[model samples]
Structures are given as structure tokens and as C-alpha cells.
Target: MDIRWIFDGKFFVLDGIDGFSARTSTRLASDEEIKIDAYLKQVHSAHVFVIDDPEVMPRGEIEGDGLITDIPAIAIGVRTADCYPIFLMDIKGRTAAILHAGWRGSYKGIVKRALEILFEQFGISPGDTVAAFGPGICGNCYEVGEELMEFFPPEFFRRRNGKLFLDLFEFNRKILEENGIEWIVPPPACTYEDDRLYSYRRRKDKSRLISTVEILPS
Candidate 1:
């Protein structure tokens, strides 16, 4: 009943939140500009943002895909509906990431960018990255045609029953694994299949699901 933390313990999901909160007010009710200052950025769903200083809550108006930070206290949040919400943490406990892996973002290789950013910008290695993928639309419920398959190579997308199913979880998991990351924990729930969850695919409507990842004890 208490679904506070997702992926077992990959990151902290503030107590009030359990998976996706439907009326988050981020889009329809509240826009980012009217809501949080500029420090929090949006990604159009493609690049990666890095948060380093935990103390600097600047009001940035940058848009990108993923977020990586070595700042222990600063909590990075990524919003998603049926898209994957992944958290990557290094063993040193100095760096962590909040990644938004949607259909478009996945096609653009946002996860790959995050790993590259860590290595080039922060000197972090892909081998040290441990992944924790939270709930999203499962393959069974995520019904897409061949068009979705073009977003990824043969390895990322697979053929299922003459239809193409996008396994963002498995795709990203393989990504991390191929890059040398072995520690990964995945959630068993599917947003589209579970009525309790908010799924854009299942509902077939326009709504947003809020899956937030934040560091605790600020």
C-alpha cells in the first residue's frame, strides 16, 4: 500500500507520492514558468542536464533529456507518463541521475548521452553506473506499429506478434549492461496495464503522470 520508494531503493519518492500523481499541475494546472523558477529545466525530452552544486538552485530555463549530479543534497526530478523514469547512481555515492526516457528521448539516445556526459564532464565511468528503472507502460500494453521500431536499432526494439513493442526498460537495461553497468533493479508494474496508474497509452487521452525522484534529508 505504501509505495513511497520506487525500484526498491534506487532513490527516494517523497512519501506523498506513489508512482504517478495524475493532477501534478505541471502542465494543465501549472506551467513550469508559473510553478518552479528557472532552476528546474525541461528536456523536450533529448539532452542531459548535470547538477553539481546541490546548493545552487538557479532558475535555469534549459530543456534537455536526462539530469546527472554529484551534489548529494540537491534532488533532481524527472516527469513522465508512460515513459520510463530511471535513476542512475554511482557506487561512490557522489553522483546520481534523473533521466526521462520517452519514445522520442529514447530514439535520441538520452541515456547514452548521460553516460557520455558523466565521463566527459564529470569523469564518471559507465561501468560504475547502477540503474534503477521505475514503472512505465509494459510491452504487453505498449502497442505500437513499425514506426516506433525506427526510433531504435534492432537491439533496442523487438518484434512481437507482427507488431512492434518498445521495451524501454530492456533497451536501456541492455544499454547500461553493454556499457559495463551491471547493477540494475526494475519495477514490476505497468502503467498502461494497471488502472491505478496513469497511462497515456491505455487512457488514450492527454494527461501527464508525475514520477519524481529526489534525494532526501536536505
Candidate 2:
């Protein structure tokens, strides 16, 4: 029920609580305590969810790790437990997007796809937009097996005490930079280490934190 962080002058990330849930895709509400309802009333926003399965889109559903929009007050969001939640905003073009990037989604280049959509649809270049990473598993606590090391380059992986850790923040930052985006905000907290945030890696809680962004109405 508590708001974790707000950024880009409009976006917000909510912390997880028991029995707290919101419909991320369409059908906004006002009584769930997720705060999406309050945001909807404030700016008349819409919501969307990212589905991991490709075949699930047939049942009036949408599937993607990222969602972007130029439409004012459309609150685009992505739910994550320990996976990185990234927020992208083009203040000049009045466009914004939110992405849920886990290991698989990141490996598949979810952020890149979001950036391409921003450029193609809103004509907002990478350098013009501001990108920020929200709470997630930090590199120090995020360890992976040897097979996963093949996907990331040497710079993203670190060997400590005979264990491998992946620097997702840096990895995603590189992706943004490679596309010409220089204005990036570092993450505020590590979900695994921060008890205030929900982390699947730390607690294995099925509850997810909703990271969302919506442009104020003109």
C-alpha cells in the first residue's frame, strides 16, 4: 500500500503488501490499495501487463516485457518480484514506457525493443529520453550458473569466492548507452537486500511490486 519511489516528475513504484493486487492490463479500479486506482482518477490512465508466454495472447491478453505510450495519462506498468523494472520517459515528446526485464527477457533484448518502439513510434531518439532502473536484484546478491555466463560478456559477470554474479544494472545500462542514451538514473535500492521491497530471490514471494509511469494530463 506504500509508494516506494516516484520519478520523471510523474512515474511511481509501489511496494508490495498482503492481499494487495491490481489488474495491470486494462480495467482500472479504485479500492485495491495498489494505488493504480488513485492514479487512474488523477489522470485517467490505462494499464497493461507483460506476459512471459507467447501463446497466451489469444485470450484477450497482451504479451510483452515492455509497454510504451505517447497518450497522456495512460499508466503503463510492469510487475516484478526480483527482476529489473525499468522506466523510460521522453519528456520532450511526452512519451513513456515501463519494462519488466528478467534474465530471459533481458537475454532476448526487451529494453532494446522498447527503445526501438519509442524511436519508431514517437520519433524520440535515444539521447533525448531519460531512462531509470527501479529496485531489483543487485549484482552482489544475484548469482547464476556457468551456463548463463555464455549470454553475458565478461564485463557483466564477476567471479567472487568461486561464484558468478551478473550485473543486470550495468548490463542494461550498457544497452541504453549503446543505443545513444546517456541520461540514466541509477537504481535506488536492491530488492533482495532491502526488506521494504519485494524480492523473489530473497523470499520467493509470489506477490509482485508494480512499477508504473503516466504522463500528467495536458
Candidate 3:
């Protein structure tokens, strides 16, 4: 529970708990398991989760990147090492969502889809939103292949030294902005370059990914 609380008067984020969730990763200690029968997570997949069933949740499926729920007592989570973790809230911060944006998730436009779903499903528009970009690989350390650079939708990667670095912050920002979400808070820290967060690129062998959570105000 090494959490960092970052909020802007209204929205708050609980960051830095990596749950090697929905995978058989060996980096997680046995004791670190959170047997949350009621909590739901996307497990880094691109699918979205909505808590429609009150029948206690099962071990979440391995597909989903964004989770939004207005249901009480149901918590959502997203895991990331070098990938981006985003928390978005609407309803004046009464309802919230946890987002996962790894390179794959980003390529799938999962965050954008999540925004659309929010508008369609919850009647929330990006104009009524505020976002927090938690710890992740910044543009400096997220070097990737030309193949990856081309995979993104032109606004993803920035070139430097004839090499490309993935700017998850910028890419996601563009997506949010296009969808009407204009307010965003970005950190000056890079997960791969900082010791505060685990980075897959920094220590490929094993690193602690950062997980962020937001509890909607009651």
C-alpha cells in the first residue's frame, strides 16, 4: 500500500501499488495478492467493464483497459510498469474510471473508446471531465521500433536522434482532447528514469508497475 495521493482539490489518485493482476507474473509476492471478490480490474486488456451484476464479481477476464462504474462498493484497477495509468472522473468527481494505456492498449485506442463509452453509457462528456496521468514511461525512455512508430495514428510517437520515443502522455492527451476532455495533469517524472515507480524498460527482468485507484466521493 505504498500509495501517493495526487489530487487537484476535487479528484484524488492512490498510486504505486502494482498488482501483478490477471497474470501469472512471478514478481508479485504471494502475500501481495488482493482477493477482492467484489473488486474488478481490466488486467491490461482493451475491453471495458461496467458493474451491472450485483452477484459478487469473479476473477476478472484478461481483456480490458478502462473500467468505469457508478456502483458503490465496486473498485476498479489498472496495472502498469512503463505503461500509462490514467484516472478520469465525471459527475463533479462522483463517478470515476481507471485506465490502462500500454503501447498495445494505446494502439487499440482503448482510452478513446473508454471516453466514448462514458458519454454513451453514463451520459458524461469529455468537457465535464478531469484526468490524471499517473507515473509511466515518459517520452525520454520509451524508445521503440519503427514498426511501433508506424502503428500509432500519426500523433503517438515523437522522433529524436533518428529514433522514436513513445510519448504516452501526449498521445493520450490528444485522444482526450479530441473527445472533449480538456483538463489534464501531467507529472514531470518518468517511471523508467525514476526509482519511485517500476519500469519495464528500465529493468526488463522484473520491475514493479504502478497501479492507481480513485474512489469517487460519497
lDDT of 2 by residue, 1-218 (tens): 23234322222332221211112211122225443311111111122333223333222244456666565545556667778878777756467777777777787787888888778866887766777778778889898999998888988988899999998899989999999988776677787887766788888877767766666666
List candidate 2 segments past 4 Å from native. Answer: 1-31, 35-60
- Per-model lDDT: 0.60, 0.64, 0.62
Summing lDDT over every window of 10 consecutive residues in candidate 3, give the lowest-scoring window: 17-26
Runs with alpha carbons beyond 4 Å of true place in candidate 1: 1-44, 54-60, 155-162, 204-207, 215-218
For residues 170-200, what per-residue lDDT tens digits would candidate 3 score against the true structure?
8888888888877676753577786645677
User: Which of the two candidates, 1 or 2, achieves a greater lDDT against the reference?
Assistant: 2
Which portions of model 3 show Cα errors greater than 4 Å? 1-45, 153-155, 205-207, 214-217
Over 36-130, each residue of candidate 1 has an lDDT whose tens digit, in order, gives 21133655566776666555554446777577666544546666668887777665455667677877777778787887777777777766656
Distance from true location, Cα of 216 in model 2, Å: 0.7
Error of 2 at 54 (Å): 23
